[model samples]
Target: MTDENTTVPARPRGGLLRYVVAATLARTADGGAVVAIVLLVTASGDPGWLAGALGACITAPHLLGPFVARSLDTTRDGRRVIALASVVHGATLAAAVLLYPSTHAIVPAALLIASGLLGPLLTGGISSRLPAIAGPSRTSQRRAQGWDVATYGVGGTVGPTIVAAVSAWASPHTSALVLTLGTFIAAGFVMLLPYSPPASDARDVPRPARTLVVMFSSGPLRRTLYLTMIVAFSVAALPIAAVASTDQLGTDDAAAGVLTAAYGLGNLAGSIGVMARPLEGNADQLMTRLATLVATTLLAVALAPSFSLATAAYAAAGIANGYFFAATLAARNEYAPSEIRGQVFVWTGALKITAGSTGTALTGAIVGTAVHLPLVLAIALTTAAALTSASERRFVTRQVRAADHVQPGTVRRD
Candidate 1:
């Protein structure tokens, strides 16, 4: 008879690294898509309004991403989801290249939204498969997550540079074509990866009751998620602010693009920093401070009288945002149970996307009309962050207690 008191260790499956690499390549496709749309509209000299409209349209699918990602929870075949989503994303990019301008703005806008919808599905589906890939070691799982973030950062930095060079050397249309081809390449890579569903696949899973419960089980996690949402929204807001600042500075869009690039640079730096020295000892307290720092910097950007000051402030915001994101995610991986991790992560992405899209839309509406757009946004973020900070310490302590009960060896193995 099998030993009743002992849990058997599962096999350490191979090809996880392949999946990671493929996922990174797929992410590069997303970055190229962003660049293709931005350059195409800007090159046309159709004014900033069209650019912003396109962005909002592209991101609209995120509003439905949570609902879409739920399918992964009910299904055991995560690999199929990832594979099909990749193909769809590739096809959508191809369609965008062939049809965006010729088919009218609305048609392309809808296509972009459909492409955006694939992201959350891919994210949720892959995360659900991690347990199979990482086996039983919690540390191994965390390491995998860290590596994934690193890959994403590297791809994000490289994609725009390539797009800029290609657009300059050829044209926006050529860049779009390149993006379409890149997506197809990425899809091919993903198809070659192995499939590994979690051992929990045999067990019955519950439907998600609510978004809040999905993301906010641990107090610290909830607080961190809120901070992250704000930061992401601020990211969406940065381009708007950059454009305004460039106009104020009597410079070209290149200046604004520089500031935007600086923000992404800061994000990469922050992600690297977090991975190098993981959040330890009072993680929630540290994140609270970082959130406060981000809020204060946003406020500073709002009040800045000069273009250089605003640019610096935006960079600072990006750094704080990245640090908070990485550290908080590390903490969540430690806190959330493996079975529900995908659900939580799915909602987290949903919140980030929703907040980001809303931020862009709100800022787009307000920046030109409002006297001090940055100041207003700053105040909003500061107030939300301050409330979160005050609650963080208590939240962390409570979560620690909860984790003590739920951690491996404390509860019966599933």
Candidate 2:
């Protein structure tokens, strides 16, 4: 007879490094997709609106995230599915780059839009697999989540940096080519993780409708999801704000890249700090504090008197945002039901991204009418997020414990 108390590890611990590398590569490539589209549109001398339209096209497909992740959650060989999605995403992106220079915008635009079908898989789906990849322990899972945040910091910083380097040296098309290669390489790394699959009771699987209900039914999870969306909407204004900030300094708008890079680096540094010391205590309470910090820093950034000060303030915002993000991820892990956790991740991730994309689209259309509109809106939205997170109920530790009981262990042994 099997020992009732026996503990089985999900995979070799060493696979964590491979998982992080794969996630970093996929995210870096995905992050560069917009930059590549913008550059390619400029080179092709297409209507400027085409670039933004294509960007929306690619982003719109995040709506499919839940369905994709639902399939992933129930499947045995999820790694294979993830790898295939990355490959397809990369290939289609490369094809679009080759097809669209100046003419035939329709086909290339369609391809870019199609590339988005698997976009969330490359992002949130990869994240959902972390618990199993890290193995069957809460301690290991939390540590893995910290490293997961590190991937975000690295990817966000490196993606655009790579695009800039290749655009400066070779061509916009070459930069896209480099991205394609990177995704393929990322897929290879993904396949190298330990092969055994985690098991779930099929009879216990929740229906799709039930999954949605489950997500919103939990207090901590519901609030955490809303916080993520609110903050993402705030973050979407960074590019426009960066450009405006440079204008304030009497510097060329290109100098805005410095502000952007500063934020990414600061985010990276904050994530590394989390890796050094994994988060403890209440995630919801921590989120409230971090969201407030994010707001404070964004306000400072907008009001900064000089480019140097603006960069520093923006970097500070990045650090706060990073910590807030880690808290968000942790909350999802902590509160979501084990069987539907992947779908919960995908749904929340998709919606948060949709909020960002919507903010960006609106900023270009309705918001550009005013000079300081983007920065002003960014600061306001971030402040709103802080206020939303601050609650009379935050100190209720009993709710967190209740959630832990309702939601079984996320990590499982095969």
Candidate 3:
């Protein structure tokens, strides 16, 4: 099964750059939206509850991502859906802008939530298009994934700064509108990219619902899902810790942002590294090691006595994070039936969002208490690593079986 790279796309590096650029622009709005919402809520002086509501809005769409991704079968249909989503997303943002005058918070929040709820379909549409654009080669597909991850890394690194700058000059509502406009522009750019649907004869013909359910049934995928969730939770620790350390230890907001940026920079570098080489070994082994590295580094970050040490720890954590993201995606790609790839990916997105929200909640609850922040994070990460290792072992066994059944001699011929 691992050797079955037949259906994967093959495209030149140049083609990937076009998609990458589009991806960068596409994600910019999403990232910028995060900052805009955060600032808006912070400025409203209801940071805790409003921020939590915003987080719910953003993560809620992911819950249905797996379900919606089942529709990514037809290239034409997928493209139309993406374009329509872009328009709707823009309209919702405009609503937010107008409703800002109400000052009741509920109306603007409804608009924000609506905008977020529609994002999965748009994102799923894009992922489906990637395979088409990349062609039928494993290398090309990997590169495409690399490009997407790189764009994500870049956007994450700079998104907050952009929001801060905009808010400083304008208002949060204006910034939100600006970000929405950018989303529409990116959607147009992506629409211009060439794509050909899987040939009708070659396309997967399974019942869409059944195929989607199968994604969660796979042992490797389940393990991956669990690990991804933990990684999401772990994500909250760094930024929260950085801010607290600075607030309590006299580190400036600028310093905290620098540390965060360093982590993102590391993620950018790691994406390139994964793209440069194919993942050929045991998927479980790779993920376990990376998860352990991330946890260990986070522990170190928690224990650091100075800003510089914390910065380095965060950067190292980012590198581990980058590797984990790439490796997990590659593994998911390798194992998932091409027919259901979008469903799997969108579900992964949901898992990531929920895990992150959980992590943030935990961080907020424990940071000011009797528990030492480093110890708490270290324990969470270490537990995650152990859990990941166990799940990966089970996952590898199932993958080996799945691989065996796919080989010519293994399954009984009809």
lDDT of each: 0.66, 0.79, 0.68
Candidate 2 residue lDDT tens string, 1-414: 113255774367678999999999999998888898898888777788888888777778888767667766677777887899899999999999998864578888888877887888888888877876776655556678878888877876688789989998999999999998989999998888777554476567676668778877776787787788878887777766787557667789889888888888778777776777767777877777777787788788877888888889878988888888888888887788777877788788888889988777666665457656776777777677667656535545667777866667565343
Judge candidate 2 at residue 172 and give its lDDT: 91
Query: Residues 1-414, candidate 3, lDDT per residue (tens digit)?
Result: 324545534444455566676666556666677677767777877657777677466556656555555555534346665666667776886687567646677787788777776666555446556766765556656666666677777766555667788889988877777777777776776667675564343245355457656866786676676777787688666676676677554577778777777788878877888788744566656667777777777777767777787778778888788888766776667676666666666677666766776787788788787335734764576566657567667767798998877886565776
Off by over 4 Å in 3: 1-14, 41-55, 74-76, 103-106, 122-125, 198-212, 246-254, 276-284, 370-414
Candidate with maximal lDDT: 2
Ranking by TM-score: 2, 3, 1
Candidate 3 clashing pairs? 8-136, 8-137, 9-135, 9-136, 9-137, 10-135, 10-136, 10-137
RMSD of each: 6.6, 6.5, 4.9
Q: List candidate 2 segments past 4 Å from native.
A: 1-11, 101-103, 135-139, 196-199, 202-210, 247-252, 364-376, 390-414
TM-score for each candidate, following the candidate numbering: 0.76, 0.86, 0.82
Global CA lDDT of candidate 2, please? 0.79
Residue 156 error, candidate 3, Å = 2.3
* CA lDDT, candidate 1, residue 13: 52
